[model samples]
Target: MLSSLIFLLGLPLALVAEPPTCTPLIPVTFDNATIPRLLGHWIYITGASKYGPHLAELKELKHAVFDLFPGSHEDELNVTEIMRMNETCVTRNTSKIQVFWHNSTLVHADDQVTSMAELIQSDKDLLILKHFNNNFPGLSLSARTPNVSKERLEEFKTHLHCLGFTEDEVFFTSEKDACPLPGEKTGEGSTEPQPE
Candidate 1:
């Protein structure tokens, strides 16, 4: 009789575990109309490998920009570009990212332009990207970004923690504001598209 009572109590306790929290969710999203300041220019990035979850550092960002699309109202649509670092899958590492921006209007630009960019989305706090088999489809690889406000960064870090990533697994550097490349210039009509 005592053992039966213990089992009943323990069963309730086992079934009442708290739901996990999303802590490490990076605040970076493609939906904000206000373009991010870090758009354009390359950024140095390091993060946990998506496949192995092992830490890896990627080469400099090839490009980062934010493009825009006008809405029927005054609102605009935002599409973020997350750079894929490897030409082919390597360790299924986290994608080497160069976050950029473009609008739905520019989706079918010349091959030269489209080849240089791709679209991504952030649902809730999960960062997702597009993938193609016969055609482009959703590739929602649960991800975390270091490029965000400290508060948001902590939140995302919590999410990462839930996903088994330690604090040392993720790192990033924004090169957009660093000293300009030789002869590089900013302001209107620059080659680099500003984040929207």
Candidate 2:
């Protein structure tokens, strides 16, 4: 009779579903020595997320280029995002990052944590980032140029599967007009398309 009672209690515990596991997540940048090497210009390629809003934002994102600069404080980074939306070159220069040990994250000036970043793969030319947020995790693939290779993209999909993300949630960036740099005199997205 006692054994029957124990079995009944254990059944409830077994019925509870366990949270999904994402593994084999190797670090792309681990220590201070390796972190510095990741800083530079990067072109946004594609992103995948289960969050509705984040996925929507990614879908709307045609193309983006960003520069990672050293901040006033150590282990901090200043990220300037450059994109073109509706013939308008939109540039945002306030996002800051606080690089941490192990897995790092993007932070704000107020010290508010934005999104946790995990590097999955980087071949100098291609990079993959997995972001673990409050309730949603997102994966991003970047490259030196918008033109990415088929192998890299396939690898990204494999990582996405491990994260429990679906192909429907993936958003591919459409490379187009790029915004001018700080002091470049070109109507990057201001005028009509030029002839070939």
Candidate 3:
């Protein structure tokens, strides 16, 4: 009887373990040649899956339909894109996508990320993007991938310079570990596949 009580008491402690903290990957610059490929549609999962919403969007891409979550809005907001052109060129990249707010929604999305003023200096493999915002914690939704290339990334650097963003203002994440998949949500308005 004493052993049973001990086991029951210890079970609660074991179950109270803290969840693993995300190893936040730093942000990279536009010079990374792989940036363009990473800019387009990507399979993203958060907390548990980095590719959750991303994979579903990919399946839709094969059907030639690109859909952004929460639909469209007419207000200023932030967005992220994971573009893909060829299977082999499925590299990871990040861009500070923006949308203008109007009537409580975003009307248009902007790809002018001002942070990446300098060229990428490392030869890493993965890319990570974190939106720096102080008001209204932004939703890390998927973005409509941009059709950028090597020349395009270079061109973008000048564009950022024109926009007045300096080199040090930008940041890059280390290219280690597997790119995570978007996790599955289990409540109303969740991105899980529902019955037809």
Which candidate wins on lDDT? 2
Q: Can you write out model 2's per-residue Cα lDDT over 1-196, one digit (the tens) per residue?
A: 9999999989888778553345576766566655566678889888887666566667667777887788888778888878755455567777887777644544334232356676765687766777766678888888877778787787777778777878787777666556566667665335332211
Ranking by lDDT: 2, 1, 3
TM-score of each: 0.31, 0.72, 0.25
Off by over 4 Å in 3: 1-12, 39-129, 139-196
Error of 2 at 147 (Å): 2.6
Give the runs in model 1 whose Cα sits over 4 Å from its true position.
1-20, 23-46, 52-147, 174-196
Q: Model 1 Cα RMSD, Å?
A: 11.4
Report, for every candidate in turn, its global Cα lDDT versus the true structure: 0.35, 0.70, 0.29
Of 1 and 2, the candidate ahead on TM-score is 2
Tens-place lDDT per residue, model 3, 1-196, is 9999999999988778653333332234333233333333433321011233332433333111122333233221224332222221122222223332221122222332232111222222212233332221111212233222465344334433333334443221212212222353344432322111
Question: What are the runs in model 2 whose C-alpha is more than 4 Å off?
Answer: 1-23, 102-113, 185-196
For model 1, how many clashes? 19
Which candidate wins on TM-score?
Answer: 2
